[model samples]
Target: MSSKLSDYDYPLPEALIAKRPLPRRDASRMMVLHRDSQTIEHRQFRDLKTFLRPGDLLVLNNTRVLAARRFSDDHGIEFLFLEKLGPARWKCLVKPGRKMRLSATAKIDNVPMHVEEILPDGERIVALAEDVDLYAHGSMPLPPYIGRESDPADDERYQTVFAQTPGALAAPTAGLHFTTEILSEIPHVFVTLHVGPGTFRPVHSETLAEHPMHAESFSISKEAAAKIDNAQRIVAVGT
Candidate 1:
């Protein structure tokens, strides 16, 4: 039977939603839904180590979050990097869309950034000031749901220890639960998928199939793909 979007809807109490990270990354609870037994197993996240074998592969997205928040004397602007179109060009979403003009300049922490062009949906193609590394100047692009300003600790906690790519605007939350100790116990490979704001967009369609998945730019090197192909099983952590 084809499932509609409403069919997949489940009630989640506001209290159940995690608002902050646990004292430890692996301290969160885990719920394993078993279809055959029609049962749910309540377990701690750390117990995940017990369920895997040595050769199993865990594929994770390692795209680091870019601090895309910008402020000025009179206005505050926020942006999320969508994709890297060229060495210095990126498709990005800008806030206060009505106030920002095409081919204008926005100062990020006193750094002059020129908006080369604008897209249909408040997106802009911007160029950073010369001799500046955009990644270094950018802050961790926190989700709007966070409802708070980004903190210094977010610079490290928001990224994986192995994160090498600097493009995603948001961290893959599921992967945030993992620790080096847990990763060391399991064989894993990292991949890059520069997640955009679309991932957090509300589902407006009536049918699940009618809801299109965002097209993300992902790269899996031959070596990583070979490792995944050779593994006994593949475990995907997050959506």
Candidate 2:
């Protein structure tokens, strides 16, 4: 059967939307829909450990969220880290797009960043002032739906415990549920996919095939890939 766009539509109550992370990472609820019985099982996320076996490889993105929000002259400007095009050169999405220009200066908590160049779609290439560590000075790149400034706790909770590479603009929400305890119980491998702003963008095409997927750079080391390929089963977390 051909799948139509309408067939994918389903109603979700506003109250069911998760506006914030659960108090405990593993405390969030999960709904398992069984196709054969047409039944839904509501369970806690931690229960996933009971269903998995040894040699099951869980693959997850370990890209760290960049603290890209900057404040300048009491005005707020948001920059989403896209990719590191070169040493000290990065592709980023700027907010209040009209105000940013080539050679423009932006400050994150007073740490200066110079706009090195501009790109298509109102994006900018920016370089931070020498010796400035962007991760230390920037704020968490929270999702737009949250509609609030990123808090200090977000710096830790928004990122996966295993995240090492630092370049993602958003949190891989599905991975956030895995705690160190859960990770120790199940074998997992990490890969880097510097997710850009496009991950959050709505799919615009009437047909799924017509929707363009934004290219995200990902890399898995040969050793990691070999482990994944040889595993008895694989589970992917998040987009």
Candidate 3:
């Protein structure tokens, strides 16, 4: 009913948000809304089985969340990896802009990286050594919305049951609700779309079409593409 972005905002009490996940992956509650009846229902995520038909195809993104946040206290900056540019180069978002000048260099976990170039959007092109892999030592790049330090538990909780590629800065949060058993019981195919930094950017335009989009990489296998092409109905899970 409102076009103003600010008008769509509402108060979200801190307690209403679950800071940590339940011990069981599929134990979280799901809110279901029926369109025809204009009714709402509350149920566990496991109940999703009852609503699906035999021919319905579920397509899921299997991109794994990377531990892409590297902090350099000595430089007073943080580097959030977005995507790779080459064997050892990456597109990154740097923090405390004032400190990371065009030619700045830092050692994350003692792995050297340099700010090769600064983009118009303020992101940096960081170049690491040819044999270096900073993600192996960096911490999870948790969304700014989460207000706590990333811990070891996040290493597991932030990953999906079907994660297959290691490039997304953030997890497809919706995919985390599905357990291995649930996916096993469903008719599904996997596609990879390494979530990019843009996943966290909010829309700034008055309409969806007016918003500028950021780039992300995705892949679909020939078999998966064929299955999707022949499916009676398709459901893209965990957007």
- Candidate 3, residue 18: lDDT: 75
Best by TM-score: 3
Order the candidates by lDDT, highest first: 3, 2, 1
TM-score of each: 0.82, 0.83, 0.91
lDDT of 1 by residue, 68-114 (tens): 65454356766665666676576677777655677677765566777
Q: Candidate 2 lDDT, tens digit per residue, 1-239?
A: 54356678899786766767878988888777778999999999999887677778899999888886655655767666666676667677877777678888877656677888886656788886654545556688777777678888888999988888877878777898888888888888888988777866777778777876677778899988999889899988875
Worst 10 residues of 1 by lDDT: 129-138
Task: Report the C-alpha lDDT of model 3 over 1-239, residue by residue, as the tens digit.
Answer: 65566777899998787778899888899999999999999999999888888899999999999899888747478888776778888888888877778888877766677788999978899887565676777788877777787999999889998898888989998899999899889999999998888876779788665778888889999999999999999988865
Worst window of 10 by summed lDDT in candidate 3: 128-137
User: Which candidate, 2 or 3, has the higher lDDT?
Assistant: 3
lDDT of 3: 0.85
The lDDT values for all models are 0.74, 0.78, 0.85
**What are the runs in model 3 whose C-alpha is more than 4 Å off?**
1-4, 73-75, 128-131
Clashing pairs in 2: none
